[model samples]
Target chain A: MNEHVKPVELRKAFRLVNHGPTVLLSARNGSVDNVMAVAWCCGLDIDPPKLTVVVDTIAHTRSLIESSGVFVVQVPTVAQLELTREVGSRTLYKEPDKLRNSGVSICEMAGHDLPFVEGCSAWLACRLISEPHIQDAYDLFIAEVIAAWADDRVFRDGHWHFETAGPEWRSLHHVAGGHFYAIGEAFPADSNGG
Target chain B: MNEHVKPVELRKAFRLVNHGPTVLLSARNGSVDNVMAVAWCCGLDIDPPKLTVVVDTIAHTRSLIESSGVFVVQVPTVAQLELTREVGSRTLYKEPDKLRNSGVSICEMAGHDLPFVEGCSAWLACRLISEPHIQDAYDLFIAEVIAAWADDRVFRDGHWHFETAGPEWRSLHHVAGGHFYAIGEAFPADSNGG
Candidate 1:
């Protein structure tokens, strides 16, 4: 299902990842594009919306993200499980157009250069922030989120509304091996009436 | 529930956090002890199980952790929601025994000086890695996971078993504004059964 991209304020961008959903890292270099699943990622900063994600030095997505200096982190839902596994294991080095081969549809945002997986609940377009030590030592890339968007069905008005959505709309959280857990039940803090 | 504290290979300690559950940061300094909920944390390295967690520099727990060089990250389940909120908001700087005031019980493991939250599904004891730049600039502390434990009811054989447990046993994933989602349903990768 197609969804409109809703703009998220930079300061509140950390909320996009605060819940800790597994994301698909998408990057492109000219005609070549790639997507890979990454469970290791967290919100590093709030004001500028910085995030840190681990990308193995050997992965093809690393070079593409480095060369383009832009990448998208897409928060996928339960319905996209097959696609997540497909893109995660199939390296782009062997098959240049892995997305097409994996049968995962993609749509490129007009303003942002990166393409987002069509079924993801939210997407964040980010520019790499150079930190030589962490990159070399931990295979981690710290980036400033340049633009952010979310599917209104699951997220709206600065909060996630997973309660009203279908099971397929719940975001995925990866555990060890290939196991994943879908997000279930939204309970707002009593302190915040909203 | 009492569970065995197994020593996870330092390299594999990152697996404990791969899924992105909000953790309770527990620290103690002499007679003063504190606990705070943190939604922002990520694995920084695998070999030594280094992790980056944001602890407000001004927080009482930060001072205790910095001085003692030890802290524990407890992955609380949905049943502990009330305790999570209580510990997160009640600062030790004001209420010296916030842990006791919150009505949450803690148990000490042999050979380790730190205490673990009794009801948590998983626990990780860590030692500071001493990254002053990130610690000062972002209030982020990088630490190595020295010990790890999990309640077999929810996690076993190196994977989360949320599908078999009740809602209360599922791990908590904080979305924003005190809203949380319980970890749900498991899907293992067909390619690698593990």
Candidate 2:
């Protein structure tokens, strides 16, 4: 296990992606590997901690996941904003050493062959749930998380502790083009006991 | 057309749900109607602006939507936090007037039979694309945006302008229980000539 990365409970894994952060999706097929930023991702189930993410049909990471049936999802923090945008803004079609170009370094994840980004706030090792129709038609992929991890400084007790962390710990929420929103403060709603 | 809500170009409609907010999914069948907060939603296509959302099979809104074959996707802002949480916490299985119970008021959209929340940041009147396999298995639904609307104060000229608007225009991204992170400041990332 990497010193900075800590394991997150599988059941609590959904909270990792729950706050709508733009994530780095990495997939390795044999020796070939690819990492790309995906803005459209969300938690689908709680106990098993399933997730749904839209991978562009033409993206290199999409083909890798399709071929290998596995991928890793990692949430990038505000400090890596430029790196996240760079990864998402370009295609890995014929580019070699794409990860280096995006300034992303991979760390070894236990029991997973995929290369997980070193500085991401959280990571999820996923086995793709095969749904060819949607994969072909909508570029939407669903996966069940088998392993999860989070940076202890930002996430503990199954909740995001962003208040104590500095601004760099904040998650990124992209709007369009190169513009992104840093996730703001967390608050609880007063429902008047509804 | 409602004075506050105006038409959004279909091509730019993806911006409505681009930042990954939990939105109100509303549907009507015969005289029965339902509204529920769904956190799992994202834009699938850009030109025609299609969307894929997960509506739990047991949800009343799901049944109404499946029967009617149409629905509305409305983005609730920070001002609607309690209402969003209230609507998501309860089910309309046997209870009557669920919308009123959640303190949400409805306004009609043109050419649609459904009611959209009056103060929402944006609205997308959708026609279901009808992919049954995934719908049955994943509780996922894909739809084409027949029409889109956005509150002028928050969204304009093909982008979200949350900076100028008050917190009422800030979109809600739910984490779990009653916790949510209001979308914060927007910034542009500099690319290294990729």
Candidate 3:
């Protein structure tokens, strides 16, 4: 049986992206859907939860995200690196269902229409807040995270419990040259109790 | 004796920030200087190495960085968490030389007047590329990295060698609540030798 998890409050959703993990951006319009890897994204606002992500103007996923105004950002674990690279390099125009083609399983949550990769540790459903200047000038898209969710085993009560969780629960951080560093060694805040 | 490292070409300087590490933003306007921790940053362009960072309107570092038209971004290692938090929490208004107050060592690099924090894994000297719209809308500043250097022991030849390097060489990733995750396991791109 699949474990159930709750959606994080919109105000607190920025915490998920604040850590700067490389995410798999998923978008769908009508029957067409696609997923691409992105390392260039940051939290833009807190309340209503705005985020900025750079999606290349020529990318196949950009149009789908622009048209649908809704997309999902999935934080994948180290074991999913192969799948992440596959989806990242291939476009939806070339591969209609890259998720399935990459041999990765997908499931749709009860409330959100977008698909989340099964192996991902956390997911966020975002709605675009179009800023044409940023998009045209820097390929940056600002969006509000309407809904957010995460695997309870890894994230609960707004804190990551990577220590108790298995290694597969750790998020991936991308370096250059196609190399990636798995999130490691959690140290609690000095001000806050560990 | 301090090591003399060659400056990275401006075009390839973006690679320094391509991997998401929380950076220490140091700035100075005449005699006044300050430093703050910022995780909301990313590479805006490749050639000429333009990057963007969000600094709150209320921050003292904002005015200093703006007036100076120059700032240094230092990528700290895992061991520097205490120092990073010290610089992050204390405002320049409270203690102008927070670096000295906090007991963290600082050094000047290249032609940049601002002091870069010592013991950081990497450093970038930048000149502000003023963009009013995004700055007003998002508290973001676009800057071009004028000079870049890395501790060869940790980062060399366009890649981070965290594995071979000691724990002190590991880069930091900030999670919410003052928590951080160190850069962990690395995987090479191809199975065959390049």
Off by over 4 Å in 1: A1-3, A191-194, B1-12, B191-194
TM-score of every prediction relative to native? 0.92, 0.95, 0.93
TM-score of 2: 0.95
In candidate 1, which residue pairs get closer than 3 Å at backbone N, Cα or C atoms, i.e. clash? none
lDDT of 3 by residue, A1-194 (tens): 06756677777788787778889898878877678889887777788788778888768889989888899988887778888777877776777676688766767877677767777877889998877877887787878888898778888888888778987767777776577777777777853211
Instruction: Give the CAPRI rating of model 1.
Output: medium
Write down the worst ten-residue block by lDDT for model 3 chain A.
A185-194
lDDT of 3 at B103: 56
Better of 2 and 3 by DockQ: 2
Better of 1 and 3 by DockQ: 1
Those runs of model 2 whose alpha carbons end farther than 4 Å from true positions after fitting are: A189-194, B189-194
lDDT (CA) for every model shown? 0.81, 0.84, 0.78
B-chain TM-score for every candidate: 0.91, 0.94, 0.92
Candidate 2, residues B1-194, lDDT tens digits: the string is 45766789999898888888889999989887788998888878889889888888789898888898999999988888888887998888866877898898877765789978878889999999999888887788889999998988889887888878986678888888888888887775453211
Better of 1 and 3 by lDDT: 1
Candidate 2 clashes between residue pairs 3 or more apart in a chain or in different chains: none
lDDT of 2: 0.84
- As a whole number from 0 to 100, the lDDT of residue B109 in candidate 3 is 68
